[model samples]
Target: MRVPIYQVDAFTKRRFAGNPAAVVVLPSFPSDTVMRAVAAENNLAETAFLVQEEGQYHLRWFTPAVEVPLCGHATLATAAVVMERLSPNLGGVVFQTASGELPVARSADGYVLDFPSRPSEKVSSPPDVSKALGIMPTEVYRNQFNYLAVLDDARNVRDLQPDLVAIAGLDRSGIIVTAPGDDGYDFVSRYFAPAKGVPEDPVTGAAHCMLAPYWAERSGRSSFVAYQASRRGGEVVCRLCGDRVELEGSCVFYLEGQADISL
Candidate 1:
């Protein structure tokens, strides 16, 4: 069998500067084993599979090692594919995912992703966390998905060189280190998730679900511009609206091809 595939760099207007996700638009849902194999073969942070159902698209994201409940960059990349290639007439698209109904709409700047807000609670930092990260966070918070670590400076967040082996042994999904941004950006963050097969992510959308609310309370603002200071940097426009967070970023196509694999 043959499967169509697309590689898209999300959260950046230019290629190779953002998180790249593999998108496969399928006529029907493939078996879990097959999807996992495809994702492993692609070896990207996330592989998004789309199947149109009842005029909406059902989307699933897989890492090389496991399936994740939520992913931001992949969803944005999928929206770009739907808008520009799959359904050119669509100005927006609703994606049914494990997280719930996610809506993506085209905006003047790029595309806006409406995601549920994930507010974290202050918690004591784990000893292993500090040992792994090499620096103790100013504050630590925990949510259902991951841990949020706050630092005093954006440089601290960017300069971190974590022990990936120790991080992979942590109990949670991952750790997000963030601090106030400079040079016009409101906040800056870096994500590490060795457990999920991503040692470090270039730009993470889902992490901002927690970040937007946290910063809103601290800075007393509802809108923000965020930067993820990874080797390949990317930016995100964030907005907090009650229980929801809006993440906006641009996507660029990297490659379009077919995967020749038999089911």
Candidate 2:
């Protein structure tokens, strides 16, 4: 079987600057083992698979290590592929996913993604996590998928050098470390998911789902301009609306090819 595949750099206007996700558009859903193997071979932060069903699309995300319930960058990349490549006439696309229905639409600012807001609950700092991160955060919070670590300075978040092995031992899928931005950005963050085969993600849109609400409650504001402080940095525009969050960013197409897999 030959499947069309694309590589797009999400949350950045330029190639190789943001997180690169492989999008495989298939005629039908393949075996879970095949999807997992493809993701492992791609070896990016995430690989998104799409299958058009009825009138909408069904999407799933896989890391090299495991499948995740929600992934914002991959979803953004998938939307771009569907609207820009597969079907240019489409102005938007709705994806039925593990996290429920996710909608992405084209706008003047780029592709805007509507995602559920994940507000984290305060929790006592885990000593192991603090040790693994090598810097203690002022506060710690946890949602369903990840741990949110709040630091006092952006420099702390940027300069962090954590132990991946120790982080992989944690219970959650990943950890997000964030602080107030120094430049025009409203906030800066870095994500580590050694347990999920992503030691450090370049630009994580999903992390902002939690960060937006956390900062909103503290600053009494509802909108933000966030920058993911990874080696290949990227920008994310965020807004909190009731129970959902809006994340806006652009994508750069990198590679387009076919994956030949024999069954």
The residue ranges of model 2 lying beyond 4 angstroms of the native Cα positions read none
lDDT of 2 by residue, 1-263 (tens): 99899999999999889899999998898898999999999999999999997878999999998999989999999999998998999898999999999999997867999999999999999998799899899999998899998999999998999998998898888899999997888999999999899999998888999999999999999999999999999999999999999999999999999997544
Query: What's the CA error at residue 213 for candidate 2, in Å?
Result: 0.6
> What lDDT does model 2 reach?
0.93
Error of 2 at 227 (Å): 0.3
Worst 10 residues of 1 by lDDT: 254-263
103-155: candidate 1 lDDT, tens digit per residue: 99999988999999999999888898889889999999889888898999988
**Candidates' TM-scores?**
0.98, 0.98
Worst lDDT 10-window in candidate 2: 254-263
Cα-based lDDT for every prediction: 0.93, 0.93
Candidate 1 structure, TM-score to reference: 0.98
